[model samples]
Target: MNRFDAIIIGAGPAGLTTALVLAQAGKEVVVLERGEYPGSKNMFGGVLYSKGLHELIPHFWDKAPVERPVARWVISALDKEASFSLDYKNARYTEAPYNAFTVLRSKFDSWYARQAEAAGATLLTETIVEDFIYDQQRVVGVKTGREDGELYADVVVAADGVNSLAARKGVIKKDLSPDDVSLGVKEILAMPAESINRAFSLTGNEGAAYTFVGAATQGIPGGGFIYTNKDKLSIGIVVKLSSLSKTGRRPEDLLEDFKQHPMIWPLIKEGEIREYLAHLIPEGGQTSSKSLYKGGLLATGDAGGFTLSTGFRVEGANLAIMSGMAAAETIKRSSRSRDFSEKGLSIYPDLLRQYGVLADMEKFRHAPNFLKNPRLYQSYPELVCQISNALFSVEPGPKKGIGEMVKEARKGKQLSRFEIIKDIYAGWRGLA
Candidate 1:
């Protein structure tokens, strides 16, 4: 029976961060990863925000396997043949303390786990945590698949991603609902750095992140994204699982359609597919599981439902890091009193709030439901493209004003003034 001060399940960002913090504080910690290596099963849409990660590893970009600093952000609305985009680029974003950087999880997570290992945290790869070892009503440790593999810990941190086995074992959180999750399918397209820079108008290590709605997903209640890496492009489509099922549309097919789009094809033309990955993303927002801790156990990251999606951006890694820090702090506080019970670990939520994990989730609590409105994904994007086409076309004898173009765009679209106003109000309340 091996024993430690704390045991963290999964070797992803959250679990590794927890291990790193605990190990740095001179506390005995072990991280169990079920994959062949730390990041063998992990995948994410490229961008990793700097603030939360910096708190864990100061100036991490100096040595971390970061692809590029994202200098341009584009949100494009695509109709069948037309597109309208809001593009913003800032030179400062390419400098130190960058806003965010494109990263490949397989490379980044392995590096992060090494940081924890360097800090003296034991990492056990290809180790599956089958179930929680319980002491009556409280969790005491985890039971692995190995012979005599019941490892004990004062506290167990479940960072096992969205489909957390520990969380599902009737303790930390409930099973995720299909309606609350999205299926994200991505591909890494290998290309020359020069080709990437030329295509995206980037310089040096500067990159671009583009998000598309409307025809990108074929009006599915979701969107598509592309992130520029050093010499590869990460492209994918994330669609609500429930909506996808209703349409009987395969995510792979949707991704292929996105790549074939006239607007997207040119950028990724001649690129070779390097890798394909898929994962489930939580979009439950405010309605997501809030129960982060229980007796002798604490859940962090996707296991705790800490991901945030607010239409404009989807954040997970940073929130995962923040939640991991909060979990480590809670365990440290509990150690003072030697109380790992639910009440002792009650401070986890407050710590999460202080870290802005809960605060941001709360701020956009209405966003999930707000985003579910079909009009935003389908009607609104088409309307924007139509309006753009009307404004840009020069062959017309009589040019229409912006207001007239908008009216004309809505005329055959079945959208009424009242419905548009209602959507505007909903957007303000849900996302603002």
Candidate 2:
């Protein structure tokens, strides 16, 4: 049984960042990934915030496998035949330390793992950690699936993705209900870079991130996303597991429908699907985040439910990197004091709070609940689209006033003013 100072499970951003930090600090760190290689099984709708990564590797865009800087963000409300969009563009985001970048996880995670290796971290692929090795009450290491696969370590960092078995090994409460989890299905559609730039009205390395609500998911409590990735487009739909079950529609079917939407078809009309991938996302905010550290074990990234899925954007990659670094910093401090106990690792969560991760989670804790309202995803979009159509339609009749148009739009709609007011108040309070 080989031993190390730290054993990190999973080689995604969280685990690799932790390994990179700890190894760079001169500590013996080993990262075990169940995939054939890092990011082999990982998938995301693309987009990696640069703040955390910039802190890890300054000027990361110069070295990272970034596809494009996201300078345009579009949020769309889709109806059956019409869609309304809010577009925001900032030229400043095209410069250094940009807001975020589109990335392919398979390529990006591999690059990130290499960075960890260059920092002296050991990476073991095709190694599935079966369970944890416990010295009475404290975790000492992990037992892999390999023959005689017990590898000891002073501390265990569980960076396993959502539905992490590492976090379930008595380190923290792992009761993740279907309501707290989201199933994301995505496709990489191959398209020429110039065609994509022309399609999105973008120039150079600028990319567009479009998020869709309402008809995208057929009123399911979820949304669709599109990110430009150089020669391809990362498009996907994320739906709440519980709500999806009630829809009686497959996620793939929803994705196909979303692609056929008028707003979506024009963007990827002739593109060929290069890859289809599905993954689970932790949608639970602070309410679902249990203890982050216990005994000699610590949980980071999605494993600890350190993800936030606001309607406008789903943010977890940056938090994962931050949590991983926080865990590494805590381990470094603990090593200096020769303490590897739960109390010693308690500083990890504090560091998360200090880095604005936990604070963001707490602040957005109401987002998931706020998003549960069906009207926001269904009737509301249709209403807004109909209103826009009514206001803009150049018919052969006298134009109606704004109030008359609104009243006409509400004629057949079942929604009442009281319901709208109540929902508005609730949404405001929930998001406030």
Candidate 3:
């Protein structure tokens, strides 16, 4: 009874998607999750891109417990007391077939797991996978913390997350370096739906997503985010793990500081804190993992380092969904002749490419390194704010030209013309 056609570790978006696909194809699949239930330990910035979930369950927003459809995107650069923002809103995004929706992972993942279960996959919750059960060098199953712990299968899928024991035990990837990951701390704040609408300038179910840099992280090489939900807000900051350690500041302390920022405080002043969460995010870009698969094992989601973090945005769930679909496709193809070797699973990368997961990651491979430039989080924002203040102030003797304002802002900052040009060029190359 413990033996199955396939075994999947973790029950996040990635593993559940893989199980859903394979189960629909008539494959016997079992998913093991260590949390009290699916999504119990999961957290994110709250936006779920439509393309991925739509492919799995067409028009999923109709059935899923999503919070709100994102209708506006705002990116703000902040100084100590000033903020410059670029806000974009599209009426089309609020309609059906939307671009993306805000989701509470705890509720969404539970609903998603049920979809997999309804499709004939078995879900075992509160079950920790101790290690992989190997035959020769090929992964066959997992050893769980159950009475009869050993469960065998033809193939094992590791979707256990950034610190995936399945991936490490199966030798699919090595340990993550501090520089390759990021630390994210978040809080869910509850407010009235009407208040949310008025504050963010949204109607009905429309929501807004905001990202902040510069003083948002106190000039740290990281940023803050706020995603509007139906009656709540998801607010957080993500920082480079290596840089965070060097600062001797607590992630929670940073979050407190962000909440008290002049621009952020007003919006969240009436909100009541409902939940606090912290998680490690993979931001290593192309260098996060050494391999995606080995022998009979395949890594997907954060386990495979499939996340993409450009300075302006961070995406993981959509990539996880796509990677999961690719893993399922690879397994189906390999099962045709019963070859689960590393060579047999070589098609996994190609499948990921075909699904557009790897392609997206590859495109932003240099983003991680580019975001490490301290000037982006510190000097640039201060300069821009100073220039803006000078341009808009009425006390100035005579209105100065934009050039004079820029040169004045550059004074005492020690920034050179060539340095500014080089940084602009680098930004174009890395983010454009």
Candidate 4:
């Protein structure tokens, strides 16, 4: 058995960051990964938020394989034949501390893992951590799929993704429910650079991201996204697991339907689909997982249910990096004191709270359910898109003002004014 000051499971962004931070602090750290390489099996929607990430590796964009810096964000209200988009851009974002950027997880994770290695941490690929090596009730180490299998550590940071078995070993009290989890399926489509630039109205390293809600998922409690990469497009759908399964719809079928939407069809007209991937993520916040830390162990990234999927945005990678950094800082402090127990590991969870990560998730806990409304996921988008189409169709209808048309559209939906007010009130309260 090999011994180390700390052992981290999963070499994705979270684990790698944690290892790098702790190792740089002069604590011995080893990261065990199940993939052939760090990012070989990873996938994401492609946007990286700046706030949490920049705190981990200052000026990361200088060395990272970032595809494009996002300059504009658009949310499209969609239907089968039409769509409406609300876009926002700022010149201030063109400079440092930029809002967000696009990334290919496979490329990004490998780069991040290498950073950890450069910081004096050992990274083990193709090594799966099977279970915790427990002493009494405290987790003191792990058993691996490697030869001779066992390794000891003072603490463990389980930065594995959403369906983490590390958290399943009785540390956390409850199992996640279908309603709290989302199944996301994505495809990366390659298109010629010129074609993409012309299609998206781009000049240089600027990117566009669009989120489609309503009539896009065939009435599922979720939506679709199209993220522009340098030479490809990352497009996909994320739906509540329970809702999809109950409706008896395959994610691929849903993707096909999404792609067929009149507003979506023209956007990807001739691009060739290059890759397909799916992952389960935590949609509902605190109620989604039972534990974030336990005896001699700390959980970071998706393992702690940190992904926040508010209807308009998804912020997982940023949160993962932040949590990993916090865990490492906690471990560093614990190492100095030589107290690696449940009470000691409790510091990691406390640090997460102090970092406002847990607090933000708690504050937005209502956002996910408020998003579950079928009207918001279906009829509303159609309403908005139809309104935009009507306003721009260049056909002869009664020349009504935008205000009159908006009133009529609201009344036409057989929706009560009270309900609209309530939804607006709830959405604002949950997400604002």
Candidate 5:
């Protein structure tokens, strides 16, 4: 068996970051990836916030495969006919150490894995860790599918993703329910760089990120997103598995409808689709993230439900990097003490708290329940469009007041002021 200080499963942002951190600190680390290469099996909405990456590798954007810096962010609500949008653009995002940049995971993950390898961490691809080689109760190694593939380590980190097999095998002691996951389907549409700039009205390397509600997901408890790469656009829809099951709508079907929306079609009208992918994402907030570390095992990233989907913002990669670094720090301490027990590894959660991963999780603890509201996905969007239509239309006769226009829009929708008020209060309590 090959021995190392730590063995990390899955080479996504989380796993790769863990390898980089531990290896930089002179700890022998090995990352086992099941894909052909690091990012071959990974997919995301294409946005990477710089906070975590900056900490790991300063000025990473100078050499990494960054698509574009997001100078504008737009959030919109769509109805069958009309849509309401909010756009915010700032020059600060285009400057040094920018806010967030779009990336192709396949390209980014490959580059990230190389960085880890350069730091003296061994990376093995096309290797599947079927199970843990346990010594009584503690995980001392991983059992891979390859011949004589048992690799021993002082500690193992499960950064495998949402459907983490490691977490399912009593390492984390929690079962993920259908309601706790979201099925994300995305399509990569390709176009000329000049054409992309023209369509989005961008100059130089500036980019835009857009989030949509309402008809984007057929009014389901999910949302749609559009992110721009250099010469392509990554567009997708993410919906709760529980909500999707009841709607009887396939994820692809929903994405096709979103692509055909009046406001969305124009942006990608002439672009050719290059690929389509489906991935499972963790949507259960902090409450679902119980027992992140047990014995010599620690779960991070999607495995630990570290993703957050605020109604206005959806973030994960940044938090994944943060958690992975925290895990690496914990493992480094455990290695120094030569104690890889549950008690020795217990500081992982404390570091997560000290680094704000746990704090952010707690702060947005109610986002999952708050986002499940059907009104946010359906009624409110339609209402906003209807009210806008009524307010902007030039009638042949007398015009109605704002109050009357709102009443007229809600007349047939079966929505009331009380229901709206109730949701408003719940939204405040949950998201605010």
Candidate 6:
């Protein structure tokens, strides 16, 4: 068995990042990945936050296999007929130090792995770590899936995503509830570049993204998203597991309902669905889920459930990259001290908090419940679309007063004046 200073499992953002930072710091690190290729088994809804990422790999936008630079961002309250939208744009993100970009995981993770390899870290793909190899109390290395495949490392960083083996046993005793999980299904719709630009109302490499609240989830606790790629559009819906289990509605059915929405149908018309993907994402995070570190062991990324959600805004990949780097940094510091134990691993959590990931999640703790608001998914969006249709109707006899139409629409949705104010207060406060 070959020994290393550190071993990182799962070659995703977190693992690759751990290797990069450790390798750069001159640690002999090995990243063990199960997939034949780095990103072969990875999938996402398709948006990258370049904020924390830039800190790891400076000038990352230059060679990353990103799809588009985002320009317009939208948030919508959907109804049966029409939807209400809030749109924003800033050309400030168009140049260097860009705000965000869209990427396919297959390409992005592969490119990231190469960066880690360039830093001299060994990347072992088509390899799965079956379990931990412990020395009485601490994990010394891993038992792999391949024959005669046992490797040793002084320390191990678990970056194996939501279902991490590092979390096995009593280490992280949290089991995900259906309410805490969301199933997301996305399709790659291919279209002519001209059509995509005209439909999304963008020119150049600029892209658009949206989060849909109402009919898209068919009364489930989730939102629909659409991101414009170069000649493709990544469109999907994320519905809560509890909602799906109770309603017994299949993801495919929910996808159709979303695509058939009056608001979404027009934009995707004449496009061909090129690829389809369905995956579950943990939305509740790992606040009470697990212990982040033990003697000679640490966990990062999805393994730690570091995803942040505020009804619409998401921050998973950014946290993954950061956590991975932090883990590697922890290893580097511990190496100099010649200590790798529970006390040494304490630095991992301190670093995470110091970098503000913990504080950020704590600040937005109300997001999960806000997303479960039945009114938003069941009533609000449809009512807004109706109000728009009624206010703009061209009647032959007479036009109703805008105020009167709005009241009628509100009444039709079973919303009271008090409820409207209450909903706004709750939503805004929770998001705050």
Candidate 5: segments with Cα more than 4 A from true spot: 287-290
**Candidate that beats the other on lDDT, 1 or 5, i.e. the better one:** 1
Runs of candidate 3 exceeding 4 Å displacement: 167-170, 287-290
TM-score of each: 0.98, 0.97, 0.98, 0.94, 0.98, 0.94
RMSD of each: 1.2, 1.5, 1.3, 2.1, 1.2, 2.1
Give the Cα RMSD of candidate 2.
1.5
Model 6 pairs whose backbones collide: 78-381, 78-382, 79-381, 79-382, 80-382, 82-385
lDDT string for model 2 (225-312, tens) is: 9999899999999998999998799999999999998889999876799999999988866743337777888888888787777777
Per-residue lDDT of 1-432 in model 6, one digit per residue for the tens? Answer: 479999999999989988998898888999999998999878788898888889888889998988888888989988776688999888876777988898889889999999999999999999998988889788898889989888899899889987788655555446567766788898989988788888888888888888888778877878899998888889999888887888988989889888988899999996899888987787875375227888878888888878888866788888888888778788888888988888877788778876666667777777666767888787787777787888776878777887888788787577998988988888887787
Question: Alpha-carbon error at 112 in model 2, in Å?
Answer: 0.6
lDDT of candidate 5 over 123-178, digit per residue (tens): 99999999998887888999999999999999999999888986577677577889
**Candidate 3 positional error at 166, Å:** 3.4
What's the C-alpha lDDT at position 344 in model 6? 72
**Model 4: how far is 44 from its true place, Å?**
1.2
Q: What lDDT does model 4 reach?
A: 0.82
TM-score of 2: 0.97
Q: Give lDDT per model, in order.
A: 0.91, 0.88, 0.90, 0.82, 0.89, 0.84
State the displacement of the C-alpha of residue 346, model 1, in Å, after optimal TM-score superposition.
Answer: 0.5
Report the alpha-carbon TM-score of model 4 versus the true structure. Answer: 0.94
Candidate 3 per-residue lDDT over residues 181-249, each given as its tens digit: 889999999999998888888999999999999998888888999999999999999888998999898
Candidate 5, which ten residues in sequence have the lowest lDDT sum? 287-296
Cα lDDT for residue 132, model 1?
92
